[model samples]
Each structure stands twice: as structure tokens, then as C-alpha cells.
Target: MKNSIFNTILVTLSVSLLLLLGGCAKTIVPPTDTSAMATGSDLEYPESHNTGTMGEAGFSEDNLPLEGSLDDNSHSFNDTDIMNMPEAFRREHGRSSEGFLPVYFEFDQFRLSPEMMVVIEQNAAYMQSNPAINLILEGNCDERGTAEYNLALAERRAINVKRYLTNTGIPENHIRTISYGEERPLFLGHDEKAYKYNRRVDFIAE
Candidate 1:
């Protein structure tokens, strides 16, 4: 019994020593791969993504845009881009129309009326203050002309206004053109007064 107890104590000491040694074992990590790999257009591409533009806000995560790129150039945003932008983002929206003038056109034609020089002066003032005002012209026509022809004429009128604005120093990029034709008459009458008012253009913010 004495020999057995001595042997058992020795065995316990050895087991404990083995377990303590194991607790201090060091973990070894393999070296990472470091080779001349390609990148920045040189690397193999996995697959392409189709980025799209937004109808409301221009850009949003829901679009699932590609890694990075311009989606489209269809924004009809004008001076109103500044006005329509949320208050928090108004500062970076584009330009202000504080001193800019509201341009005017002729009575029967879409061309800038000779009397509109004052209106252009006002627009020039507005432009002086706003500096970055984007202009969108929506040409309109009276009910005297046919719908289709009127649409084309209205477009021409808007284009004519834009051309003149550009001649006045406004950048062409800042002005966009569209026509309303005879569809949207300003006055509800067949008289010359109403026709005069209807044959005009409107500015829209994107």
C-alpha cells in the first residue's frame, strides 16, 4: 500500500506538469501570400453592373449603381433646382436667382419681343446675383395653330429665347428647351388678348 501511494503521487505530478506545459504552447501562423498581383484595370473583372439614374433625387443607393460612374445626362434641372432643393441642401444646389431678370418673349411669336429688353435686363440682374442659374424654357403657343405645328413652333420659340439668352452671356448648358404647343393656354378665351398671353414660355426647375 505504501509503494502504491508513492507511485500514484508521482503519476499525478507528471500529469500536472504535462498539462501546465501544454498551456504555454505557442501558436504558429502561416505567412501571407505576397506576389506581383495586378490591380487598377489590370485585374480581372468579375462582372459588370448596370447603374441607373433616379427620377426623384438624381442618386440613391436603391439604384444598385456600379462600382462608380455617371448614370445619365437627362436632368432638366434649371434655376428651380435651387428653389426645389431641400432647405438643408439649398446651399450646394447650384445658383440663386436673387438679382436675375425674368426674360420675356413676343406677342404672336416665340421670339424675344422688342419690349422684352427690360425683362432681359431684369434677368441679367437676376443672373448677376444668382450667377449659376440654370434656365429651362417651356415654349407655349395659342390655339390659332394646329396642335402638332404649334408644338414645333412652341419648341422653336423656346429655342429662340434660349439662343438669345446665350447671346446675352448665359451659358448654353444653363438653358434647356421644351415646347408646350397649344396644349396649355394661359387664358381661356378665343380673343386676341388671350392668344397673346398664351403664346409665351415658362421656366421650370428640374
Candidate 2:
């Protein structure tokens, strides 16, 4: 009778020990979707999915040049000079250069906003009226992301503007596109106020 009682106690103790161990154990579940595991820091522009020309060119930040400026100042008329021209001369050549405003974009976005579309429409109308005037769309980006990535993003921004202009009756050949990336900034600062100005596509006479 004593042995049976001792055996029951021992069995109870063993079961109790197993329960304690099971309570202490943790069950690890592996992530089912690897893409969902990406954190904000993993991507430079977390909101933007398009990598643009970087993928096509097979370029990385390490491979790109550190110091260089892209400029083609071969245009005959500057904004000030064009604006100061006589009314008759402008009518014969083109409208006031002030009409060609810089087109701005949202953070890390290449898609045109409704407001930006209106700006593009005005620029396109001017271009359509003055077929002799060739224009350059200078794509720029804020001081964010890798040089290669920014260049690619900027190129996409300019290409989108050009696409809109062409769709609005502006000849493709009359428009040249260039990407300055973060090399040329309208405002120099890390804040959104400055970044908003830097992220733009300027219209320049070519």
C-alpha cells in the first residue's frame, strides 16, 4: 500500500514538472511573407516602389560618380531675358518665360498631382504655340536616397513630364530631358520646406 502511494506521488511530480516546462517553453513562428518583414529603414524611399532606370542600367550607389554636375547651357534665352522681351517679340517667339513654372512632386513620388498637371498643361500650350522653341525638362531630386537611386528617380520624374507634354500635342523631339538628381537643389536644408522645392522638374529653354 505504501509503494502504491509513493508511485502515485512520483507520477504526479513528473507530470507537474512536464507542465512547468511546457509553460516556460516558447513557440517560434517563422514569417510567412518575407516582403512584409521589411522595415522602414530597409528602404530609402519606403513609399516609392519604382526604382526607375537604376534597374535597367544595373547601377548601385557605390558605382556612381561622387562629384559631377549635369548642365547644358546652350539655350539662347534665359528666363529673365525671355520675360523682358517685347510683347510682339514674345508673341512671335513664345509667351513670357514666367509661364513655364517649375513642376513640383510629392516626397519620393514621380506621379503628377492634379495641380502639377495644370502647370504642365500651361507649359504644353506654350510649347504648342511656339513650335520653334525647344525646351529641356531638368529633373531634380531632394537630398535623399543614394546618388544612383536619386538619378533614376529624377529621370523618371522628367520622363513623366515629357510624356504629359507629348500627350498634350508637344513634339517629342522638341523636348529634351535631363536628370540632375540631388546635385542641384533649389533650397539647401534637410527639412520638408527645403525638400519640397528641391523635388522638382524645371522647364528651361533649349
Candidate 3:
């Protein structure tokens, strides 16, 4: 009788152990990706309607707003920020840069292609009409290269675009250049198409 009781107890303990392990297995989770986050920015995905070249990725606080993000209520205000003006700023960079057309770039190259040249000409026309509007020549890259290299490359792209603009009479002071490096990408896919979209510069109004 004692042996019978002992066997039953062992069976019960085994069942309990199996249940515990199963529970633990169900609770286990994979690690999260924190690379997309900027310093002091929220660890989770931010609530953004930004569907620019970055596509669905939110521009963390580290990105700031190129130069032209304005407060929600007004237009062409330099100190105004976009967050305060999310209502329409999402549609256009707003503030100093309303009606500005943001351009995309190819991966790892700083030269504006023939198509990009057309964009630059359009911007030249708008800026010529609106002198107080400062330009933010923001550059971005994909996640393939070293961080430092990507940053330098992005800067170069911005410079390249600025050179074109300068030749077209856009003053040096009118455009400010910034490089986001490989820290931002339009799509998270590891492919040629996504990489191409990421390796470009953005134009913001200040």
C-alpha cells in the first residue's frame, strides 16, 4: 500500500513539474529592437503619422524636425515646432517650410540624379518666392554601413544637393545640412528597394 501511494505521488509531482515548465515556456518572450530609438526618446514606437521617405518609421526625438517644423496653429514661424502642429504638419513640414517638397535619395550615393535635379529646380522657385523660408537639407541612410560611414555619406549627399541649390542661387545660409546616417530607414526590409529609399536626403523648412 505504501509503495502504491509513493507511485501515485511521483506521478502527481511529474504532472505538476510538466505544467510549471509549460507555463514558463508560454511566458517566455523574444528580445526587443531598440536600435531605432534616439537618446532620451521613448523606447516603444512613437505615435507618428510620418509616411515620408522613412515610410512607417517614426522620427524619434533625436531627429528633431529638420529645420522647419512649426507649431500647429500658424505658418512660416521659425521657432514653431511640428508636434504642436501635428494636424497638418504631417501633410507638409509647415512653419518656415510650407509648400516645400521633400526629396528622397538612393543608398550610399550623394549625387542627385536627373530626376532629383527637377526637384531642386522646383524648390528653387518656391524659395525664390519665399525668402524668409530657410531650407534644412537633411540626409538619411539605410542600416547596412558602419554608423560613422553612413553619417559622413549622408552629409555628403546633403552637401551635394546644397551645391546644386547654390549654383541655382539658393544662398549658403538659406540651407542647413544634417545627416541622420543609417539610424533611419523607410522600410526595415533587407533588400535593394528599401536601401535605395533610405540612402537619400530630406528637405525641411526652418
Candidate 4:
């Protein structure tokens, strides 16, 4: 009877120990989806995804219109206003030489404006009235651009003016074109006002 009770007690303690060991054993947590964990890194670091140029990847400030550009309304008046006036009035205005007007261009553009066309019309009429008169169209530019670029731009300005004058009946042989680039500035100051004055094509009777 004593042996039977000891064996039963040993068996109950062995069962309890087995249950405690099982309870203490660490629960096996299956490996998580590591792909999902890595998805957040791309959002956290932006430069990692950089392919190359700003234009290729996304928007850039260079693509936007510059603030306070010359195109703003404040600079509405063009050089033609002062240049294309009558000889008597121009002398009073004290801006241009006798019987001719200077033509001006916007920053970085070779295209002639409506005001420029009007000035050219008056110039054409003057040349028509005086058949012996020959004119030299001197192209110029502002101080902002590179020397080579400005030279090319000035050439375009002069050529365009010459073309228009020829189209208006001034003989092509009568007009000569020259580019001074930024070397000859009509206005000496460095502001936009000065730049506006500098970017011009002056007409000198040769």
C-alpha cells in the first residue's frame, strides 16, 4: 500500500513538471513579411529614388516663370516710344539722332514687336523720300548674357531689322548690319532700366 501511494505521488509531480516546462517554452512566432517592412524606406528617403535630371524625375524651379521678370507690367513702355518720335520732337525728346530711330528688343528675343514695325514704317518712308540715303543697322545687347550668345543675338536683331527694312522697300544693298553686343551700352547704369536702353539696334546713316 505504501509503495502504491509513493508511485502515485511521483507520477502526479512528474506530470506537473512537464506542464510547467511546456508553459515556459517560447512561442514560435512565424517570420513576418519582410517585403512589407521594406516598403516604408522608399517614402522615408526621397533622394534614394533619384534617377537624374529634375525635368526627367519631377518639377523644377527652372521650368517656372521667374518672379519680377521684365515681362511684368511695370516695363510696358518700349524703346520705340522714345526712338520712333518725329525728328523735331525726338530732338526735343533728346533721345535719338536725326531722321532715324533705334529699334529695341526684349531680353533674349530677336522677334520684332508691333511698336518696332511702326518705327520701321516711319524709317522706310523716310528712306523712300530720300533715295540717296544709306543706313547702317548696328545691333546691340544688354550686359546679362554671355559675350558669344549676345553677339549671335545681336546679329539676329540686326538681320531681322535689315530684313524688315528691305521688305518695306529699302534696297538690301543700301543697309549694312553690325553687331556690337554688350560693348556699346546706350545707358551706363546696371539696372533693368539701363538694360532696356542697351538692348537696341541703332540706325546710323552711312
User: Which model, 2 or 4, shows the larger lDDT?
Assistant: 2
**Tens-digit lDDT track of model 2 for 79-167:** 46665766445433332245487787776666676677788898888777778888878788887666766776677778778877887
For residue 56, model 3's alpha carbon misses the true position, in angstroms, by 31
Highest-scoring model, TM-score: 2
Q: How many backbone clashes does candidate 4 have?
A: 0
lDDT of 3 by residue, 105-183 (tens): 5543444556767777888888899888877776667776556556655665666677778878988887777776776
Superposed Cα deviation of residue 38, candidate 3 (Å): 32
Model 4, residue pairs in steric clash:
none
The ten-residue window of minimal lDDT in model 2 covers: 33-42
Of 2 and 3, which scores higher on TM-score? 2
Which scores higher on lDDT, 1 or 3?
Answer: 3
TM-score of 4: 0.55
The per-prediction CA RMSD against the true structure, in angstroms, equals 25.5, 15.6, 13.6, 26.2
Taking the candidates one at a time, how many backbone clashes does each contain?
A: 9, 0, 6, 0
lDDT per residue (tens digit) for residues 1-206 in model 4: 99999999999999999999999987532222222111112232233432111222112222222122122222112456755655455322223346877787776565566677788889889899999977777777788656655665666667767878887889988877777777666566898777766778777675
By TM-score, the candidates rank as: 2, 4, 3, 1
Q: Candidate 1: TM-score?
A: 0.48
What TM-score would every model get versus the actual structure? 0.48, 0.57, 0.52, 0.55
Best by lDDT: 2
**Which residue pairs collide, candidate 1?**
77-206, 99-125, 99-126, 100-125, 100-126, 100-127, 101-122, 101-123, 101-126
lDDT by residue for model 1 over 14-44, one digit each (tens)?
9999999999998532211223111211111
